[model samples]
Target: MGANATTLHPNVASGGAYDHMKLNNGIKYSFTYELRPGSGSSWGFELPENQIAPTIEETFASLWKFAEEIYADDNATGRK
Candidate 1:
């Protein structure tokens, strides 16, 4: 993936797994989560009050899954 696209779906940024996407309405928002058991044990997906968790949940989950499918078993970190 290109640098811009990869940055848009960050699994670690600014000390967290932060990500951002643009909505159809032209509004932009960001979310962050955790996957390892280092500082915490929660996969936090911060969203607007009116938003749902499933969207971010699936996004992060699918990102990893997609990486697994495209990379070798020993180097499947979903990272380009």
Candidate 2:
């Protein structure tokens, strides 16, 4: 799916580089996520056309979950 279009690829729906496989069930999804050498941090999420927009709580919870995943990954290194 194009960035300008409403339909989203599973990668975009999930968080691009941080894709968590949150795609709709029963459908196979695959994407290769790589951060280019000069790229800065970026994030994204997919709100399916059938699902309502996330509530403030849902958004925050998802954010925290993503943060935790990063914190847990051995490859993620930075100031503690």
Candidate 3:
């Protein structure tokens, strides 16, 4: 897998870090996710590509769901 491509390994870290592992073999799927650092007391988001919301949504929804767990509600919420 390349830095810019993977079935896993979204930028799942925010104000933190972790490891991503993919065990399923031959399961080729494209997934995308965005992790914004939300400690600036500003609006933040963890969207899966807004331009093609549906495509990105469908592909990465599962990964995004688990990824979000690492970030606390406030960190991801962008609350001031």
Best candidate according to TM-score: 2
- In candidate 3, position 19 carries an lDDT of 17
- The per-prediction tally of clashing pairs is 0, 0, 0
The whole-model C-alpha lDDT of candidate 3 against the native structure comes to 0.43
Model 1 TM-score, all chains together: 0.27
Kindly provide the TM-score of model 2 when superposed on the true structure, using C-alpha atoms: 0.30
C-alpha lDDT score of every prediction, in listed order: 0.45, 0.41, 0.43
lDDT of 3 at 59: 50
* RMSD (CA, angstroms), candidate 3: 15.3
TM agreement with the true structure for every prediction: 0.27, 0.30, 0.21
Off by over 4 Å in 2: 1-54, 75-80
Write the residue-wise lDDT of candidate 3 on 1-80 in tens digits: 33233323346522221212222343223233444432563445543355456655655775676557535554677743
- Which has the better lDDT: candidate 1, or candidate 3? 1
Span of ten consecutive residues with least summed lDDT in model 1: 14-23
lDDT of 2 by residue, 1-80 (tens): 22212234444453442233435342223334222222343422333444334344565676687677767763465535
Pairwise TM-score winner, candidates 1 and 3? 1
